[model samples]
Target: MVVKNLIQHLAQLAALEISDSEVPKYQAQLTDIFEHMDQIKQLDLAAIAETFRTTEEENVLRDDIVTPSLSQAEALQNASLTHDGFFVVPSVMKDKDAT
Candidate 1:
């Protein structure tokens, strides 16, 4: 696709407000990026192993052990709101009646 049309389509899909003066600049940038991606895709990697990460780091998570003990009343001691047997929280939806 022509850069102008591609930029217009992308701007519409992304809900972006790009001025006409900025189209050429964005077009150049996107063109360069796609060119680099194309170069990378053209590389022959048949002999290379698939890699998910570039670094040689290993997982560093601590061992998980079951050693926690807290009653429901104790857990809700500092809460500002509570119902019968659960915490009462304000509705996160935009409207309380929305479903």
Candidate 2:
């Protein structure tokens, strides 16, 4: 087959100037694969239903349920400093007293 011939041609490419570790195995496989794919492309499918070619299966999902996130207070509960239900940190801008 043309694919096999292409694979053989690619395998022979290892003898070309390069490195000993270099091999065209993937290139050869790609050549063969594309040739095989060309066979599929050659099909006369004017009457075949394309949807039947799909392999999709039905999906199963869990039931939706109400969920709650941490409230502002709970979210900052582990903060090192808390003030009036909010996290407090040193002022990023220089305080006027420090200036």
Candidate 3:
């Protein structure tokens, strides 16, 4: 539904053709939205704090402790170039000294 008539409706809602100058007017709507959000925040949330959505459970979180991974030699066995116990790649610095 949105993809259809999106081009036609945009000019009507925006009061101007979609172009570089027209973008800021749409972005300025955010200021009006933040003003409304400020009004909602002023209300006392101390007592009537219920779960905002139907779900009331804390997000079950996993422990952040480390998980084991493959050993360095095993991981680097297939690399194109490696030396001094580490993977190597092409140097990003331009070789300006080369003639």
Which candidate achieves the best TM-score against the true structure? Answer: 1
TM-score of each: 0.53, 0.37, 0.36
lDDT of 3 by residue, 1-99 (tens): 123244447665655457656556555665567778889999898998677877667767887889899899998999999998899999886554477
lDDT scores in order: 0.85, 0.66, 0.69
> Which residue pairs in candidate 2 have backbone atoms (N, alpha carbon, C) closer than 3 angstroms, thus clashing?
none
Give the higher-TM-score candidate: 2 or 3: 2
RMSD of each: 5.7, 15.8, 12.3
Residues 10-37, model 1: lDDT tens digits = 9978768789999999898998899889
Give the residue spans of candidate 3 off by over 4 A.
Answer: 1-23, 49-68, 80-99
Q: Could you tell me how far off, in angstroms, the CA of residue 36 lies in candidate 1 after the best superposition?
A: 0.6
Stretches off by above 4 angstroms in model 1 are 53-59, 62-99
The global Cα lDDT (0 to 1) of model 3 is 0.69
In candidate 2, stretches whose alpha carbon ends up further than 4 angstroms from where it belongs are 1-20, 52-59, 63-66, 69-99
TM-score of 2: 0.37
